[model samples]
Target chain A: MLIVDRVSKKFNVNGKEKIAVDNVSVKIKKGETVCIVGPNGAGKTTTVKICSGFVSPDSGNVYYDSISLLNRKKYLEKISVLFEGIRSINWALTPLENMEYLSGLRGIKKNKKDIEKYIEMFELGDYKNQQCNSLSRGNQQKVAIACCLCLETDAVFMDEPTLGLDMEISHKIIKILKTYAQTNKKIFVITTHDSDFIEEIADKVLIIEKGKIMFEGSCEEFKAVQNTNTFKEAYLKYRGVL
Target chain B: MKRVITVFLNELKYSFIILNRYRINWMFGLSNLFLSVLFLNLGIKSFGNYVTENVLDLKLTQMIIGLFVFIVIAEGLNNIISKITQAKQSGVLEQIIVNPLGSKYIFVIKFFADFVIVFISIAIIIPLTMIITSKIISFNIYKLIILLIPLLFCTLGVGLILGGATLVFKKLQSATHLMQFLILTLMVIPSYPITPYSFLPITVESMAINKVFSSQISLSFGLLAFLYAHSFAYFILGLLVYSKFEDYAKTKGILGHY
Candidate 1:
């Protein structure tokens, strides 16, 4: 299990104080997928980054099992995070080369098979050997996501994992995550705007806006908000977009 | 050790790939360095040179050798900032730091990889300079290396200080240039027995190198001991400064901003 307790973060952008994440607490048990959805500037990415140990929060702790995840090495080893943008992949190298170096660091030996599977699944076979920077934006994201998948970790955190992916590859990823989560009994905490995909995969959902959690409940309960049958409708109704 | 080797070997491979990709860069840089050395050597002739009252009593051949030593030190120290800045801007530093092998080892591994490149280039540059000037100055390779070793640690220290500042500010080009120039001036200052410039970071070490180069001393144990001690001091200081700045950046939540 992974637990985020009362985490809050603030930043100063151009001399103005801005709250990125405010008093947000979340918990995920084994074999569970939790999805966070919100509008732009909702602090979804910041919260996930904090959980991944890349960004530190102002006040709170993230715990794995019953112990505080204080050791960065131990925490990073246990989790695989889908890094966002160029921060995830080294543009100086190829997708395969990155997998080799990065996976080697993670002590994940012989990850070529895993890398090849994702390359084939995402139709990245043509771009695998090319430098990551030269690839298109969508393709670079694929490399980042593929690198994340090379780890056989206990928990996975991804932000906008399906963004920029084609529907075919996106659907394939859902199936892959579903099987991996089930067989490994892993914890997954992801944030994305894909309502239908969330409806399909997420056991629980968080609706957030302006650094606050507007709603938190099971997927079914989230869909049942305002008597809406679809998650899109529930989200629209709850966010006051209707 | 195993993880370090893995990272080091991979870094080597990438260096090779980059070298092969831009073969002209190597050729251009070498030719440019050769020209600069040649020009300096030739330019000195127009001055109607006179002999020195210094300790080494350097003739033209000796002067060439001494300048070449300066070049070697400069070559080694010059790349650390640019290489680190490149990695930082490209997000390579951020991505690699997260590796399970830990950030500290990765930094050292990358340093060794770059140091290897500098070593190879210097190896090539010396022969090319000697051939270009047609100056035959004999010195012990082992002795030269012994003296040169301390400068590596000293320069690594300087590199770390600059890298630390880079970790926070991100736009330190002017500061980096200022430091490079300062290092060059300090490194090449005329090291006479009476010059009194020995307090510079590499001054004593460079004097040792010149002594070995002109065959004035036979690889003295006292000098080597001094170097070994100072090398420890500079390297440790560098590590501390880098770590201090890294800690500050982490606290400010600004490590990966650039």
Candidate 2:
């Protein structure tokens, strides 16, 4: 389980301070899939980064199973991250090379067979040897997912995992993630504005507005609210737009 | 300690892969080879003219030693500037910053990688210089190796300092050009006798280069040791400055500023 306590992050823009994340606290239990929904600049990415220890918060702390998250090597090893950008992987290397290199970094000392399993699982077998830059956006996302799952960490942080993916590929990714969550009991924390995807996969939903959590509940409870039939309506209602 | 080594190995692996993928290593090697030949020819021509004119009583081996020092300094500075600039452009800088490793480790690995590349170029240039000018110049391998160390340290130290500056200024063009010019002046001005200029500038330049090329003193090894110590001092100082500025850099979102 991960607990975020009163975390705040601020950045200076042209000598002016802008708060990206307010004093917000959240707890994510083990074996659960939580989706955070927010518009652009709503501090979703910043919160994700703080939780992942990529960016230190201006105040408060993050604890993973009662241990401070700052500079904790063991905690980091248990988490895998896929940031929003699709080009995070080295584009010059072939997909196979990329996977091999990352797996090596993670101390996976196996050969082609183990890597081939991930390639087949992600449906990337045909493009396994191709350079990442040459692959289509959807295919590149598959490679990124394969890289993340290769580590097979207990918890995964995916920011906009399905961004730029086609419907067919998106469904495949969701199905895989659902199956992984059920079988491995891995905790998946995803931040996205894609309500359809969230509705399909997320067990719980947290709506954030202007760096604050406006609402938090089960997806079913969220849908039971009047005019909350769609994730978009729920988001709009939380944003006070309706 | 193991984690530091792990991060170091990762950086080295990534740098080697990137270097090969972009073909920069091969390009740098080829260019260094071409320039070393060109410069050696120019140095030989100038030395031959000096010998005919009876301008100095130095042996051919002595002239070759001087030319070797000049090439090492020149190529060392060039390699440093280009590598740092390319790293900035390649998004490697930002990637290193985000990792759990400290900035000092990143700078050190980058410096060592560039230093190795420069050292390889120097190795090639030295042998080629020996071959092409063998008829005119003799070789003293031990003296050559001894003279090369201080020059390499000085150049590497200055390169890292400038690289840290690149992170601050976010553009390496001006800093790199100025460094190249400064290195050239340091090499060429000292080749002439030290007495012709104003006493102050001459004294300053002489002391600075001597500090860099400490082995020239030929006394106890204290001066050479001091030079090495000072090189590390500058390296640490650069690391500190980079670490402090990195916080501001993150706020400015300047990790990708280049």
**What Cα-based lDDT does every candidate model obtain?**
0.73, 0.65
Top DockQ: which candidate number?
A: 1
TM-score of chain A of each: 0.86, 0.92
Find the candidate with the highest lDDT and give its number. 1
True contacts kept of each: 0.26, 0.04
DockQ of each: 0.41, 0.25
Instruction: For candidate 1, write residues B21-131 as lDDT tens digits.
Output: 777998898788778877866765544345343422344456666566666556555566666677666655655555666654566566767777766776787776677
Residue A104 accuracy (lDDT) in model 2: 47
Counting clashing residue pairs in each candidate, in order, gives 0, 0
CAPRI verdict on model 1?
A: acceptable
Q: Provide the TM-score for each candidate, comma-separated.
A: 0.86, 0.78
Over A1-242, each residue of candidate 1 has an lDDT whose tens digit, in order, gives 89899989888889998998899988889889999899988899788877877677888889888656567777777787775544677776788887776676554554577778767755689988998879977677767766776666788888877887778667866776776677778888899999767977898898878778888888889776668888888888877897
What TM-score does model 1 score on chain A?
0.86
TM-score (C-alpha) between model 1 and the true structure: 0.86
